[model samples]
Target: MSAAFDLEAIRRDFPALDQQVHGRDLVYLDNAATTQKPRAVIDAVRNFYERDCSNVHRGVHALSQRATVAYESSRTTIRKHIGAHDSREIVFTRSTTEAINLVAASFLRPRLQPGDEILISEMEHHSNIVPWQLLRESTGAVLRIIPISDEGNIDLDAYQGLLGPKTRLVGIVHVSNALGTVNPIKEMIAMAHEKDIPVLVDGAQAISHLDVDVVDLDCDFYAFSAHKVYGPSGIGALYGKRKHLLEMPPFQGGGDMILSVRFEETIFNEPPHRFEAGTPNIEGALGMATALEYIDGVGLEAIRKHEERLMKEASLRLPEVPGLRLIGQARQRAGAISFVLNGIHPHDVGTILDQEGVAVRAGHHCAQPVMQRYGLSATVRASFGLYNREEDIDALIRGLESVREVFA
Candidate 1:
């Protein structure tokens, strides 16, 4: 691999990466679940709590004003990061799950009829699937799924066919968490737009791996989590077009969400704040902005190149192990690889890998539909990050060999 980036220097930024696990250096490959925090992000969170600890947008005190400024500035950072037209279009939520549920409840539910349909893909995480299912039950609407090929790419022909008069909205994942298939979202958005349908992109996995411009993609709504990109947990952002935010109802009712409260009628706040109810994750938002700044300093293009090389190397070497079968070989993949041994359970594989200090996710990955499609109960998934090195892949390969010998 080309040394375009100083990998050692980059790894030093993440304090967690310097530790030892089970008598070996920690090879953290569970980045799809959540990335390790960098010192910059940690300091940002600590600084906020120590110096600017106050509730936002309400108090007239100096601390509150400073808190409000920092909190809103993070919103501006996120807005520019995603190329969103206005910061008012960005609504803070607890996580990507909450963000998707917010849109399903606030935007889709109010307009949905008994027979309306929500189109999603077969490869979606449960966060994307369950919310729409809840909406379906409430409104008696139907849920339609776009099938994926054996290679893990979405069947675009099937997706186009599924869209019809009853299709109220389309929700799709920008990248498959389990498979690492980067869906052609820009084209999918265009297809949906032709029929006057709005599309929501689940970007939890894509935001860190790719340069996501909500404006360039022309997606109506995009949701992603902070922790997926080396930020703190319990915070995420939902980006909606200004018009949609203006039209959508508040997902929850609370102190800051309302302008005036009356028993008979309540006047709600404007777009962004209307959706953000109660006390927000003030420190988390600041940390997420700091994380974004760190990513910017590293440069996303360099990160992408580095990770792609890692993925390619791992892909070629992993299947060479006895009894190992690589799953989901999409032509365009990113950041993750899922595999299963011929006679070994994924949990067992994960157990053995962990003993060797290689952490990987081994389960349905909250995407049961994907498991059902592939006719497997689970798979061992090792997802990469920018801080990961070539040695991590080598360690994983050696660990898998040990697993094979034990099973043999």
Candidate 2:
């Protein structure tokens, strides 16, 4: 956070950043997909395997007890990080995708019925859209998409018109993975509450960039993957309000999720544990906690400010390149910028950028409907993160010189 925060020191923690992609330093801009883990997170993961390794919640053995403490301690750490009122409200799932699926399966599928509408914005990722679609297919609930404005933000008045007595759940992304538009979720959540419709904030692209207070947002459920926030893959969290989690049925049936298992009847455990089935990824959870600590230590506000500077600087400089069209000019955004090249296909641009050792994401970014909303098939996206520097965008610009030459 200070002016003394060393970029080189932070970059050194990520071993992957030291590699050469194409005779150049790998300038990775795909932070939205998964952030490179810091040395702290990596060490935390390694420590688990090296010293403590055992199944959690069921063992009195020394190894099991140590592993269980590390794993559950991670949950406690995260609960405080996200401002959840209770630790039991936090459910560990494989990733954000699985977390959303848990809500769709255990909660929405049971309560939703024919003619009920599940409202979402056009900008939701495929994970958010598909799970609700699945619930629709099973329960016959209509899926209504709130439209986006020309500026790439959701039309809130349109959303209000869509919400009514029949509207059951509002599943919207807090930040667009494709557009990088930060939705006014606090307002949206309040509106949904006024109408008694529960809202679930898909925070995959948000938690890495902003502080999320689940109680303050007042959303029924919020889901995000740890890997997106500089943690390891195969780990994520679902934060559900205690009342909602208590009412919802168990997501998966297995060893830890049950209180007592019988051939005829299996009683499920309480919230969080009820949804977390099987022997959990113990190391991943501990590493995720360490990852949050890494952020907390550096301070999330500072990271946000640094990325904001990069975004503004990149936005100002990039438009100078001819035939480069910036997409998603929302008033509030974070960590990502989507753009289209005049004559080059998105894939072609990515291929050429890779030649310069500059990596960027290309495609709809799992937001097919959002692409359709903006009348685009796909676009090349360069996203920023904590470790990114102004020189990174300069490298990105230098890489695009080839795209201009080739397309010209």
Candidate 3:
């Protein structure tokens, strides 16, 4: 196997990285927030607007047919990407947040009764938390949190005891955005299956780094953001089993999601279309196909191997800064480091790092409860992706060392 990837070839595809930031060559460690798009994805969206700018599904004209074919073809592209059983199981949504809300609203709401529980992790993004809170409020179902240890890894022994007859659903992140913990989702899913409870794995952080197959995982549902996975914004997809998606109520009601309608009565369409409504984001979906294509070309194993190398280097070097402490030291972590420095607020660390031409995410990272659990308001987070290299990690260390020196 080749020990190298053509980094320059890969870097040239992202136009945003071609320029300077603060008079310095950009380091772009902010990938966990959103990835920079490839030229292919940009062109895919542009091509749709320039040539096939029309509404989808209903029009008999050529432009509409053009739009419909491109838009629907993207669904097939994504269905194959995640290895879902059928394209009909894929439903387009606004983003991961909207996708999770779709399941919480359409499926969980009706099935949940009083005393039924929604099991989620303490490390979940706020997107995973709020929807279940709404479900609890609406259905009187209890919300049970699977706690994490000091290193930010979930306690599986504790989680197993929580999984019992009353557990209606298990929603957990495939990777923790803040902690960089790659969750044991396959085992988690298998355990949930034994209990006869359905599971939904939030693949928002995992899709960029690992292979994802909904059928292989045997998950009841999976949700992830297109933007996070090198696709365009305002679009994402949900993979659900056909039977479950067919039974769930439509998350939103509008045109294109229905088979037939009247002023007096109406009927919704089959699984995928039943969940997608209104004027869909046709261009965004097309761009998602481009992003998926680019990722496939790079190969997920290559991406993960590169990221793991970066993480290994960072793990060895990060603790060397005087007064710096690392959080989330899970042995099975992906490419992230959430750290704190003595006598410096995480926000201050972020601002100072920004001034030094280094961009890193800081704060609770939408995992405030985890922050509170660790007695921290926040910590500075630096997450790695396929594009990152040893030089970036070196720059991060040098930047943090400057902060340590100045603060002292």
- Report the lDDT tens digits of candidate 2 across residue range 215-256: 888889999999999999999999999998999888878889
- RMSD per candidate (Å) reads 1.6, 1.2, 1.4
State the local distance difference test value for candidate 1. 0.94
Residue runs of model 3 more than 4 Å from their true location after superposition: 1-4
The regions of model 2 sitting more than 4 angstroms off are 1-4
Better of 1 and 3 by lDDT: 1
Candidate 3 residue-wise lDDT, 57-109, digit = tens: 98999999999999999999999999986999999999999999999999899
| Error at 40, model 2, angstroms | 0.9
lDDT of each: 0.94, 0.92, 0.89
The candidate that wins on lDDT is 1
What TM-score do all the candidates reach, one by one? 0.98, 0.98, 0.98
Q: How many Å off is the CA of 394 in candidate 2?
A: 0.5
